[model samples]
Target: MADSSPSLDPVELGAYFDLIEVTSLLRHAVEQQLREAGELSYVQFQLLARLGDAPSGSHRMTDLADGVVYSRSGLTYQAGLLEKAGLVIRTPSPDDERSTTVTITEAGRERLAAVLPGHIEVVKGLLFEPLSRDDVTALAGLLAPVREHMRATPPRSAAPRRRGKVS
Candidate 1:
């Protein structure tokens, strides 16, 4: 192995490790709860939640991909699955013929309704139980800047896709 100096200080390393472990554990539990309650994947639930929250009850496929921070191809595939299940409908966007719009159906809303209680419970039990209100406020305050900094770099989904064949 090539030798390299350790860059992170012990405090930084501990914080990073703690963040990773907590997110991993939280995601695992959330995924299980989503599957058991609504038969949805974490990504699918995110998509539905976004659609449900949209004023128009719909969003462009590209926007959804960006909003969810998912790959374009993966978002397309997940949308297809949701379409097959009759939980969402994908239509050619009225604003842009080349783009698709995904809208949650009534069934999708119902599925979310079924899942939310369990989802909230899981989040509360695993992520919030140990934290006091002040702790949570401090955590959010501490993490917001980090999240913003990471987001300063454009997400892959924000880039223009090459259409057809590249010369």
Candidate 2:
């Protein structure tokens, strides 16, 4: 006996494919510009920007990780790289020895300031420049619900586990 199931419509699948392709293209464009300017990766730029925007240019590492989309271990690794580059420094939190505080160095601030204008221009060109004011407002409105839903949902655990043999 043979089994059959309905296949996904090509048109519907193409929409999802287009979405991924467009997002990848935009990321690639931005990354290329950033690389031309310097060695900063998107994640590094984001982390520095976060610290730069914080009060006193400092934040707890955990809070920084939470605000950004990186895993805790990933954040630590990146922070280590930033520290090695002398763009950031880590200090033991006065209130908690277990927690470390990260601060943007003068070098970090200068680097971010230099890169920011170009980054903004690229963002405007790739994303906002094409949109009218009303279109930008509408796009922001459309994304709000999804952002809220994501914030409301807690993240899952990242624990490692052994895989078992399947029957």
Give lDDT: candidate 2, residue 74: 88
Over 4 Å off in model 1, which ranges?
A: 1-6, 160-167
Clash counts per candidate, in order, are 0, 0
Q: Note the residue pairs that clash in candidate 2.
A: none
Tens-digit lDDT track of model 1 for 41-117: 99999999999999888999989988899999999999999999999999999989989999999999999889999
Estimate, for each residue in 39-135, the C-alpha lDDT of model 2 and write its tens digit.
Answer: 7888888889999998789988877877787788889999999999999999998899989999999999998898888888888998898899999
- Model 1: weakest 10-residue lDDT segment is 153-162
State the C-alpha lDDT per candidate: 0.93, 0.85
Instruction: Tell me model 2's lDDT, rounded to 2 decimals.
Output: 0.85
In Å, residue 13's CA in model 2 sits off its true spot by: 5.6
